[model samples]
Target: MMRSILERASHWLALVCRVIAGVALIAMLGVTIVDVATRYLDRLSDGAVAVTLLGSVELVSYLMLCSLLAAMAANVEKSQVVVEAFSHGLSPGFKHRLQGVYLLGFAALGLILCLGLVDSAAAAARHGEVTQDLRLPMGPIYTTAAVLSLLLGVRALIHALLGALFGAEGEVSHGE
Candidate 1:
């Protein structure tokens, strides 16, 4: 029962992350289009109607970061790149073990990255770092990124455990 509940929660979390990523992507596209249109209008009007959105670059950068970070969990869960070239001839059990080891390694790497991000975020907060154009605080953004990284590490670790216990073939399914 507990495992079932945890699985459900994981599914919902992955879904939410994917949804957030999609929203961020759409927002970034809209902002970029508006910024470009404003630039074009400014040129046509000979600077008479200056309408460029301030801090657009900063906004876009934040949106890109959000999109990338938000999508990471879903990507790790569902979009793992498969390369059959190297393991084509391996037996199923061997392949599963290999994949389990690889996933554990990936989880370790993610943990390291998460730690680095945490340190970076603390430094940014201490230094009062902010975006140049918008003066947006960099600390919160870095902290959020660190949270996402931590989530990715947890997800990868879960996947590794599943693979190890049940074989890669018995790992979590997409269900679609």
Candidate 2:
């Protein structure tokens, strides 16, 4: 069977987001490991060899944000927490529609997040904002976040459409 272009595109984009999330996770781990090591080194030196990673805390914070945001776009559907209690008695078709409606809510939220981030990024750029410790430009980070958030919205919207029009993730709706 041939798959729709939307399905293909969403799959590819989700894979990319997963990769980005993986990289962010690795970077976060490295930063945390180094920061902890520095703490241990400081103790070992007894205040003589005071070495620090300066902005390690700030770096980790941004990395953590990136990790979570990158994972969001790809995993929105997979990560949804369903309270089956209310809908357990409903038919599968009805349940699928309900899930689609739920995803639409998430799509709306993602778009709102994207818009807010875009505004924040523009403001940061205009004000020459920088992170407190690392002095890294805030505009770029916020812009990246905005882009990821947009992807999240788009992905969720597509999934919502598919679920509403068709059925659940793998089930054929009516006659296919």
Candidate 3:
């Protein structure tokens, strides 16, 4: 199939998304480190101790987790994972089939997780659950994470279908 502009755009967007997620992950890690260090500093003015730091840590942690899901999806899309060790000896057709099966199972699992969390998150949203200090709505975080995971699942399902149809890795050269 000819690579359309949309496909090319998606490829580039995915790379950018991966980079953004990577940077977010790093920031989250750094924030967490600071939170931990300051908490144990044993030298803070009674009024200088702000509760927002704790909330910031929570926010960063949630962002980190969401970014991780995105990263996994991007990694899977790019065929970054090393799976050749066991399948190297298998014929290409057989290996492709195996990969399709694997991807399908992974997608199924992700769907299950999203389904399980939807109700609990909704309840939290309805009851106005919030962080102890910042009192920010936790519902949005839960909802966003669920949706992102679901999207990732859909992407995996598509990849699996593509792999089964075209062969593993989706690496067909038109000229060759």
Candidate 4:
């Protein structure tokens, strides 16, 4: 029952990350489209109007940052790049245990990243940092990144325990 709950929590975190990534991607696309369309508004309106997204680059930067960071949690298991050259003849159970250990290492790395991001966020908040073009406060962005990094760490840990310790991959994935 406990494993099931953790599995569900991991799954939900991934789902939420996916949604955040999608929204960030869409917002970036929208910003790009608007920037392009309004690039020559002064000429298009024959000097009657001058419109352009002044800080579009900065806006897109934050959006892309959020999208990439948000996707990290969801891609923990699916995006593991491995050679697997020496493990050709390994037993299924051994492979499961090996994967679990590898995931633990990933979790540790994620946690380290989370800690660094938290420090960075705190510094950004303390110093009143702002983006160059937009003049937007960076504390919120850094805070969001720190939170997502923590989520990646936790999801990786949960995936390691439930997916490998229980038996196989399907133990953590009962419905989807």
Candidate 5:
């Protein structure tokens, strides 16, 4: 029962990430449009257009990075990376053991990244950093991204372990 719930949750989370990615793409498009409009307005006004364009650039760049992260996380969940060399002539047991090792290493790396990002974000927040023009606070975004990355990394490790233990290559569905 718990396994089923985890599987379902993973699927739902992937779907949500896909949706957010799509929305972020749309927002980036909108930002481009706004930048264009502001350029035209700049010809009439003194320099208000420059400010708006800069703000849009900053906001859109950050959003697009977030979207890319979402999509990349989904790819990791799907096990979409190529592992061609390891595919040849390995026994089932060996393959499973190798996968387990890879997952544990990856989990450790992800934990380190999560900790570093959290520390960086906290330091930035303490300094009261703000983006130019928009003056947007980046603390929340940094923290959220770090947390999500951590969660996704942990999930990936768990799924990899589960598959290595009880699942065959064809039997496990990695949110495909």
Candidate 6:
């Protein structure tokens, strides 16, 4: 019963993350298109309007970061990468153990990244850091990214535990 609840929760969380990432990606694409179009228009008009999107670079950077962080949990859940070359001849049991170890290591790395991001966010908050043009506070963005990193760590740890206990067959489905 508990496992089922956890599985459902994880699936829902992954779906949310994927959706957020997709939105961020679309926003970035739109922003880039507008920026480019405006630049072209400015050139065509010989600087008559001098139109340019303010803080576009900063906004896109933040959006890209958010998208990457948000997608990470889903990617980890899906095991998106497959490197069969190294483990081609390995037995299924051995491969499962190896995968478990890899997932645990990834969890540890995520934890470290989350801690560092938290510290960075705190420092940004304390220093009143802001982007050059938009004066947008970076503390919130960093904090959000840190939270996503923590979620990724939790997901990795869960996968590691499941793999260790039940081999490759014990996967938590993300509702297909």
Report, for all candidates in order, the number of backbone clashes.
0, 0, 0, 0, 0, 0
Assess candidate 2 and give its TM-score to the true structure.
0.89
Scored by lDDT, model 5 comes in at 0.67
For candidate 5, write residues 1-176 as lDDT tens digits.
54565566656666776787788889999899988887878877877556456678788877887787666555444554537585567766566556655666656765777788798789879998777768877787788677657755765666566546544322234322
Among the numbered candidates, top lDDT falls to: 2
Q: Model 2: how far is 157 from its true place, Å?
A: 0.6
RMSD in order of candidates:
2.7, 3.6, 4.7, 2.7, 3.7, 2.8
What's the best-to-worst order under TM-score?
2, 4, 6, 1, 5, 3
Q: How does residue 85 of candidate 5 score in lDDT?
A: 80
Candidate 2, residues 44-147, lDDT tens digits: the string is 99977788888988888888888898898978777665577887788877776677778898899889999999999999999999999888899999998998
Q: Please tell me which predicted candidate would have the highest TM-score against the true structure.
A: 2
Clashing pairs in 1: none
Output the better candidate (2/6) by TM-score. 2
TM-score list, all predictions: 0.84, 0.89, 0.70, 0.87, 0.74, 0.85
Q: How big is the RMSD of model 5?
A: 3.7
Model 5 regions lying over 4 Å from their true place = 40-52, 91-97, 168-176
TM-score of candidate 4 relative to the true fold: 0.87
User: Scored by CA lDDT, what does every candidate get?
Assistant: 0.74, 0.81, 0.64, 0.79, 0.67, 0.78
Residue pairs clashing, model 6: none
- lDDT tens readout by residue for model 3, 59-158: 6867788788777656554553436777678887666667766788767866876776677689888898886666878787677667756755665666
